[model samples]
Target: MANKLIKQMGLPKSIANIFTARNIITAKDALSHTEFELMELLDVDKEEVTSAMAHVSEVVCPPCQTALLLLEQRVRNETLAGHLPTHLKGLDEALCGGIPFGVLTELVGPAGIGKTQFCLKLSLLASLPASCGGLDGRVIYIDIESKFRSKRLIEIGINSFPEIFLKKGMAQEMAGRILVLRPTSLSEFAESLYQIKVSLLQQQVKLLIIDSMAALVLGEHECGTSRQQALGVHVSFIKSLAEFSRIPVILTNQVRSQFGDESRMYSFQEPLYNKR
Candidate 1:
């Protein structure tokens, strides 16, 4: 039965026999172990183990689909995997709606450029009802710089959507939907991310905003390669979270003038994974 199941997964007879010899009778049995454990148990190389695991996963829990099929599925579900509008007419039009879901959107500029304000507006919009041009979901705001103020957000909400904010108990209700976490150190920030992952499963989170990535890094580490490496890990994890949850993630970054040419400015520090 084990050999037959493995064969059905498109593995060769030799591979099936190896699994049987190792007492991995079912796909679940094989998948129960990590890739490294599988490699050691079956005495196969990394690629072989990876390929075998991919095959098993493909059969067990499939998510792959062609472009047309994905579109059809979205249509059937009546939920288009689209962007979340920022509600700024010019910016929304430039983005063809708004900040895209399942990707990282970075806001880089010098101090007092309204990055935090923009993020707060987005958080408010994300918490609003679908009828009010929102995702009708919650927001997880990782406020590294401690710049997230409830009062300011409420002001933005009042100005942007007076009809909704003017309603009785509406401001508190909207405020309840945005959960903020302030992690002072890098380690705490990473742990907060793990907690956010669990929260995502338990909540209808539509947007995530990290206000000022530069402050978090600069506060902990000095200017050097170590800072870049640490930031890269966090950025990669955040990217994965956005893709996994199928939500929009916004990150704000600070800028500094060039060393020689003070007229020109660039991001204070670029993450190692940053291509730009």
Candidate 2:
């Protein structure tokens, strides 16, 4: 079956030279040229091809998947190796020696658990000078909950990367570059992210923050849909944005409460212990 597909695509048997033995027959080469050229070679609808790849790649040893995985890991490692230092001396060590780039890092917990404070401190640290422990990259704060406080940010910035705001003129300029977006609706929130992506591509921003995922989706709960569907859309949209922009997206999610009696706990425990 794989041989027939390869023959139909006009690919050569020498594909093995480019792919590993496990994946040589199970994948189509990604187009290296224009979209029209890709369409001509694949001879399939773009959406169909995307869906087919998503399904088949899960079950087969896909050449493209293997190659892409390696490429992503290589980029991640290189970025981590070259990452700038942070002011909080022990923070980097806590994170396995350095901040990672091109990958998402999730810091989750209940409210008032220092999630926002941690993000604020990290943003400031990200903007500091190399000598003073900073990455010198612009930060974009997406305040979906309207919780951003410029004064607080400045205070944290002063402590974490004081040199960045030492001069009035430089401070104002740096503040202007530290973009902030507080959207009132989901559409607006999503649009702001798209704008952020465009800005990043144009060298206007670097780091991104989406504080408290629950706040963004809580408004949608009034629509009365199933909880799973609501969460699915929210997660899917965020994932899509991350993949398309190839930027790190830090999204904080809320945990649901569990309520039951001691007997209920015992019932759950019994099932787990009985499994063995």
Q: Scored by CA lDDT, what does every candidate get? A: 0.80, 0.55
Off by over 4 Å in 1: 1-80, 257-276
Candidate 1 TM-score, true structure as reference:
0.67
Q: What is the C-alpha RMSD of each candidate to the true structure, in Å?
A: 8.3, 11.9
TM-scores of the models, in the given order?
Answer: 0.67, 0.61
| Per-candidate count of clashing residue pairs (backbone under 3 Å) | 0, 0
lDDT of 2 at 190: 66
Model 2 per-residue lDDT tens digits across residues 55-133: 4344344445575677566555635545433444686554444444544445556667777877776666665544655
lDDT of 1 by residue, 1-276 (tens): 222366568787787789889988888788789999999999989998898888888777756679778645533432356888887789877665677777677887778989899899999989999988888999999898788899999999999999999999999999999999988888888899998998887899999998867677876777557777777888889989988888888888876554576643224324322211
Error of 2 at 198 (Å): 1.3
Best by TM-score: 1
